[model samples]
Target: MFINKAFNMKYLSIFSILVFTLFSSCNNPSKTVNPEEILIQRIDSLNKAGYDITDYHAHLKGGLTIEELLEHSRTSGIRYGVAVNCGVGFPVQNDSALSAYYRSMKDYPVYQGMQAEGREWSTLFSADSVALFDYVFTDAMTFFDKEGRRNRLWMKDEVFIDDPEDFMEYLVTQIETILSTEKIDIYVNSSFLPDTLQSKYNELWTNERMQRVVTALKNNNIAMEINSRYKIPSAKFIKLAKAAGVKFTLGTNNTDANLGYLEYGLEMIRECDLKPEDFWKCKK
Candidate 1:
């Protein structure tokens, strides 16, 4: 009887080991979730639901050819708005150059955009030339601070922050002035801060400051860009802007060829309860 019991126990132990190995293989980490697949599905669902998703701040930089852009658009299911930087330092400086750029891209199915750089862009480009594009956008990153210093927020060397609070207030005023004065349809790189102040973005960008900027955008009929590169204009700010009836746009603001699928903006859509009607579409 004892011999028979030991033989049965050995078989039972082997059976248990086999079952565990099978379940372990099935639940292996290597068979993990496909985030790319999930992302594609999410985009597909949104597109099917009548969301005209488009990235209105893509650039043709870093060997990113127009043909490549078209192919990416086809595969990604997101449209593009090819913009040329228009200002003193940029390639398209004058009205002639701007017009030529537009003419070159006119036959394409994408929206031609003018990325107005610096405060002097209005002085450089003609109104007729500016009107040639599908839409125009600008950001307050290029502005003079209280010290009369041209503080380009993106440039670490140029940004000056003597007092964080005072600098933030200055930024808010600059945004207000840009919205009120600039002839722009959309504002890209919204709510951006310098590297030093970036970590304290939440603290520096106070309620009053955000409200001021949002009110300016609403009053001037400008759309706010939800930038994917920086993932900025926080959910709180977006919510406030939505409450104030401000429209939103998605932007990759790409510096390279790898133009993402606007993942951050899509996340914002679900988080901030944004709908199709909340987006700003360029009506040509």
Candidate 2:
């Protein structure tokens, strides 16, 4: 009888262990929750709260067609502003080409954007032609340096960084000039540095410099773009600009078909406490 009782006790212990293992397996949190899904849920929650999460710098490069863009917008719950590159080197250089491009996209539901490229864009496109789009925007990327040499920040060959401090000062002045003189509604690629100076962005973009740019945006009534691709204009910059009553727009500035969700811009919205009223919306 004692032996039988001991055998039964061992069997009961094994059964209890099996039951506990099964329960733990069923309740495992890691198995049921995914990080990507959580991020999507958060984005959806923000959308439901009436925030118009739109990307104003989507390009048609890398074979990204309008139909594909529209489908991506529907699935991602993000509105889009399709932009065309307009300048001397780009395909849409003249007013006729610009008008043809606008006419081609007039029937689409997305906002048509004119990405005025290069410093000579003002001379290339007339005011009447510029007014044909929902909005016009430009960046300080293609500005002539103090040496009178044209510098495209993204191109390593074009960018000439002699002194970091001098470069920063020059860039800040160029941004001010663009804001003061250019007839643009938004300034895309705000606070971007060349690859050489990119790592020193925080050290270079001082409080005084940030304030100067913010003041320019406020004075000119131009909105600043929170670019997702470059993830520029740090939270500190955004907060300062917001305090100075500078409006902002979100942009992806995508070069390929894989247009990433505006992760950085959304994070800024939460961190900076940006409201829908602070965004630049198209009247059309």
Q: Tell me the tens digit of each residue's lDDT in model 1 across 62-152.
A: 9999999999888888899999999989989999999999999999989999999999999999999999999999999999877789988
The residue-by-residue lDDT of candidate 2 on 19-72, one tens digit each, is: 999999988868887765665666688789887888899998899999999998
**Model 1 deviation from the true structure expressed as Cα RMSD, one decimal place:** 3.5
TM-scores of all candidate predictions against the true structure = 0.89, 0.89
Question: Please, what is the whole-model Cα lDDT of each candidate in the order they appear?
Answer: 0.93, 0.91
Which candidate number would show the highest lDDT if scored against the true structure?
1
Candidate 2 TM-score, true structure as reference: 0.89
Candidate 1 lDDT score at position 193: 89
Which residues of candidate 2, in runs, are more than 4 Å off? 1-36
Report the C-alpha displacement of residue 123, candidate 1, in angstroms: 0.4
What's the CA error at residue 46 for candidate 2, in Å? 1.3
